[model samples]
Target: MLGGRAVTLTVSSLADVSALLAALPEGEAAAAAAAAAREPRLTKPAGSLGRLEELSAWLATWQGAHPPRFERPVARVFAGNHGVAALGVSAFPPEVTVQMVANFQHGGAAINQLCRTFGIALDVVALDLDHPTADFTQGPALDEAGFLAAFQAGLDSVPDGADLLVLGEMGIGNTTPAAAIACALFGGEAADWTGRGTGVVGGALARKIEVVAAGVARHRGLPPLEILRALGGRELVALAGATVAARLRRVPVLLDGYVVTAAVAPLEAARPGALDHCQVGHVSAEPGHRRLVGALGKAPLLDFGLRLGEGSGAALAAGLVKAAVACHTGMATFDEAGVSDKG
Candidate 1:
């Protein structure tokens, strides 16, 4: 129910999307173009700065400042279990959720490693969707009334002074729900978004699609909240709420993979401004992922064919953001660096 309140406000028209898109600073594109033009004359070989210069311009535009600043970066990973796992949609068992949460807490997960490397703070939250609730005694699960409560807890836990937020997931069998949700939002076949989640094999993949299709069928014509109740996982709901909270707080969100993006759709629909703070980390290897990004009108930063969840892509993309900020803040202007200006 955490995101339930927010989901009720979903946007249902392209006009809504247009208005939100229009609100983003027009100066960002102009700044990026200017940076692209200026990078060639910085006393270095022309275009030697490569993507770094482009990234800086983007950061400047996004932050609405000539030089962007990345003061504090935080990665938030949300974990939950799914009731649909009974249908064999995932290769890994539900136990992995608890295990991975523990690993994250103890500093063994990939997110933890990446955060340490980048000097970004990490926050992990465990939510119970409907099943495997016994393991996550430390966190609240989604029930009729506890949904919003869980989401608020996660929102409040985000560290003070954080400038960027990266959202990741740790739920077994979640891809099934994510695919179903994407298909509903985009009106696509379940198979289109289905992939070998956590190394699920051929037959398992087939069964996963079948099960998700059934869920989608049962929930047809229902509202987004009801669809979520019937087919969505708690982690997804919580992530959606967090996305809204981040937007309201004016903190940029670095999105990881499909599951996280799926969670954000409801928020993006409800408050189009919510997405202005989001940066797609990468184009996930999952076929459905590209479709989702396209639907959201976003271009991801990387394309290494990575399918691993846990905010890995977001963590990796953080380097690009840092470099962009550095270029904006560290690079000297034409007059200050004493570089010749092209009249």
Candidate 2:
């Protein structure tokens, strides 16, 4: 059903994710050539549009179309409860995750407004809110079965006919897991990645750092995906899965914030270029996000000091994508307008 593929593979194992990685389609060079050819004729000085021009070509290359159409962008926010929240790592309680999901459903969240403003459909997947992951300070957050289930849930969250996917998460205290993931994947001290999630102050932020340090120390030296299973929450893993699913479907993805970036970081670490079709929608106000994006070599599309997750930043980036696509497709050529071309 997805991408008109005859075989639908379920991500029940990390090996399956590996297989998907091996099978990831390369970008369309011809479409990129087409985009490049059109960009010069679009009545603008060469390279004047900056990222908008690059964004247009990126849309063409990833969407595999001559003139890319940004019609069906979808944002999916995965919400889950983290057992690590019990450590006083975040200002908000885990129960807030469930409540926030209801807010998304009721069109009451900032993401809801962002989605309406950007014309992107928003879907929320609350993964096992009643069953929070085991506290990673003591042990693995999710065992193999639980990990696979959340990963599969992520893969399934991606819908068919989606032109692009914007991934965000709504798990309270999840920045702890996200920090842990970044620490494990990037070989950083926990304090470097841990930040004030939910506005935790001095003591709470320090405790969050300690918790991240412990989680990474306990689950270090594993494969990237295993690190993710050990340190990341359900919503994080699901975002990773949806990213894989989007790439498999040849759909581009806009990633949101530190948590979402950390969620998908393992994939790129596991297999280089796994996230080539993906871009960070914005640099989060979270301290670690700027460093994380720098590590991934992705210059974010927007940066307004936004730390609100739930795909709000990504939905806002969708508007940029639409503008990029619109300019690429709708702008008049120098020849068509009878304007002077660069001589």
The lDDT leader among the candidates is: 2
Identify the runs in model 1 with alpha carbons over 4 angstroms from their true place: 1-66, 129-146
TM-score list, all predictions: 0.81, 0.97
Q: After superposition, how far is residue 239 of candidate 1 from its true place, in Å?
A: 1.1
TM-score winner:
2
> Per-residue lDDT of 1-343 in model 2, one digit per residue for the tens?
4333433558667788788777777788999999999999998898888999999898888887789878888889999899999999988878888899998999999999988988889899989999999999898899989888988988888777788898888988999999888888888788888888789998888888999999999998999999998998899988888988887787999999999999999999999999999988999999899989999999999989899898888889998999999988998999999999978
Per-residue error at 259 for model 2, in Å?
Answer: 0.2
lDDT of each: 0.69, 0.89
> Which residue pairs in model 2 clash with each other?
none
Backbone atom clashes (below 3 Å) for every candidate: 5, 0
Tens digits of per-residue lDDT, candidate 1, 1-343, equal 1111222222334343233323333234554566666666555555567766666665555544454567788888889887667567788878888999999999998889888988888888887533442211121223434454445544565554567788888899888888877776767788988888788878888898887677666665645544444456677766765665555444567899989888776555544555766888988888889999898888898998988899999999998888767765676656777977666
